[model samples]
Target: MLSKIQNTFILIVDDTPKNIQLLGTVLKNVGYKIIVASNGIQALGILEKIKPDLILLDVMMPDLDGYETCKRIKESEKLKNIPVIFLTAKTQPEDIVKGFDLGAVDYIVKPFNSSELLARVKTHLELKFNQELLQTLLNFQRDMVLMTDGEKVIAANYSFLKFANCKNVEDFNLKYDHIMDLLEFEVKVEKNDVSKLLRLPKEEEFKVKMKRDNGEYLIFRIKQNVIPEKEVSILSLVDITQLENQKSSLEEKASIDELTKVYNRTKFQQLFKNILEENQVNPKSLCLVIFDIDHFKKINDTYGHNKGDDVLVNIASFIKSQIRMSDILCRWGGEEFTLLLVGSNIEDGVKICEKIRVQVQNHPFIQDRQVTVSMGITHYLPNDNLETFVARADNALYLAKRTGRNRTERN
Candidate 1:
């Protein structure tokens, strides 16, 4: 159809003005934009400015001949793919063979029929368009694609070759059973029924963990479809290992404090609520301890904010080393910390708090100065909610601060 050539451009190069005009008129009448050049030199000059889809080159010309011009075109990396067809009066078999050897797609004798000229032009242009489209799709695709005849690989894209650790498809031994053996996880399809499995619903996808030849483990979501006409199966693999890792990283960051590297207040509260609910059902002794640095604001005022941060960091590290793995320690706020001790009553909580107080007083902080902490301990009550329970502990903390600092008080 003429519609295919509507937006296409063609170049006509000839020494004879009559021949150039005639060829231009034929191509122009069929909806192609035409550019004329008198000789090979002029054609090469015009090529610098405009890239035509097809070139109708004359065999004989003055100065630079058609053969040399076509040779130069083929040599150029940018212009090499444009189809060149020879239009000349020479009908010798040797001359036609020479034209083809010089990179001409087709040769038309001087007294050529209009129908023949148009058909050759249309066919070559359609072939060029399809080749370019296929290359573009292959270069831009992200998923790894492979074409297999159930027993061996027929073809594969660049992604598949890279995953297989092969420089090219020919270098890889891609046998069906051999590849299945390399995978760490099993595929749902049976060994003898790969083609039958591919004929299942197109929406079905399989998740697999594969151990690559390069000693790396990769997770892929794979889909397969059958090409009934070719008697082959097309397989697509989408890598999802990075996506899964990102999800886990996000969940950990959400529950952890950035500065202190401990559980944050939000996550601590949620965990505490869960523990409280479990304790009510099982009736186990549990205790909550709330503590804060004594004269923390005075330290910040005396020696800049940086030193204050150092003190806080050192205190948190020290406390983490002293606590059991089962205990939960959280940074409740700027200078305050809260602890949840499972299977511990008020007496047990007091012993732990006193130990922590003595350690804090003896440990050297920034500038070799001693830091002290005041603590308040309270046991869980049978009829206590989150608000009422925390309120009692907070009241005990206030009493400790009012009476004297650097000591533990129980409520």
Candidate 2:
């Protein structure tokens, strides 16, 4: 139950003073503000200053006729949506047809019925108000929404313009085939079946990879619903790029040590088990190397825990730089690190461990002092489980520490 005559603005363009005065009085009495112009030139001038909801255009005006004025109004982007009703005395069929062709919504003949004129004006004003409201709602939506008739774009929301990198409606060159291009990554529907999908009453959601204007691929969750009565489909797209990135960042954080930024114990174990499973199918040389900083407690006790942390961080960085991409490095515990070398024997493991020990011994640590690591290297045996395999490497590490502080031992 919406009010019909609520602060509506109407512009009257006619050469006759009596006609302008009569129409202005009738419209103003019905709660509509009126603006009058004696000719088309004055009307266009007034239009530049004020945006009216509707225009009452007289057909036979001096110089600029109603047909020409309506044509110019429709040609304008800003004033095009205003409903124009022709005020004319011509009753010929061609004359009426000509008025409509120039974008006139309705026509009132000379000696017009006041009731008929007001009724048409009220109806068109209400229709225009509803259209403006719909456009406003569409512009306010965050998700990109579009209406299509299975082949052409009928309407698009503001978010769609932003998504497509279009500044205005004129720049938006979207077609039904463009939608199919976006769906090509995951949803494989034939062109013929597109119409069938749009006829569905239920909403369908799809994860699609859409390439943006910046040449980056972003993930979007597209939801489509069909409006059978309108013969059009509504498509809403929610950009999930940030959500997907956050999920990936969380997964990466879970698998990495916060301090050293290398794989943690849990991730190392998972990767090691995967390698072992793969090795069982096709036996390949694999080795485990365990190492710990020598006299790490003394460094922490004398130089402070801050220096101890620096020592660990520097050692992890050095080790990471020395290892191959295939090798998995992990901070096993406080002051200790582990390496899993795939496609390597005990001899290869020992050689790599020796290089690490030498580099660590030569590198300057905190307080201008030097530090070294004792390492244990072990090759995978025929029937070695996780415990036994790790224990062998641990035993060798103990042997290296027992014999001397800065050396490598194999088991």
Query: Model 2 off-target regions past 4 Å?
Result: 1-3, 14-34, 58-62, 65-68, 71-77, 85-123, 138-253, 270-287, 301-304, 342-351, 366-370, 377-389, 395-411
Instruction: Give me the displacement of residue 259 in model 2, in angstroms.
Output: 3.3
* Local distance difference test, candidate 2: 0.84
lDDT of 1: 0.82
RMSD of each: 11.8, 5.9
RMSD of 1: 11.8
Residue-wise C-alpha lDDT for candidate 2, range 1-411, written one tens digit per residue = 153565677899999999998898888877888889999999999999999889999999989999999999999988888999999899999999999988889999988888888899888988888777877888888888877776556677888877677754545644324456544436677877776776666638777788777888888887788877888888878889899899999999999998888899999989888877765423347888889999999999999998899899999998999989888899998988889887777777889999889998998876568799999989888888778888999999999999977999999
Candidate 1 lDDT, 194-257, residue by residue in tens = 5555545564577777777778888888777777787877778899999867988998899887
Worst lDDT run of 10 residues, candidate 1, spans 174-183
Number of the top-ranking candidate, with lDDT as the measure:
2
Q: Residue 127 in model 1: shift from native, Å?
A: 22
Which is the leading candidate under TM-score? Answer: 2
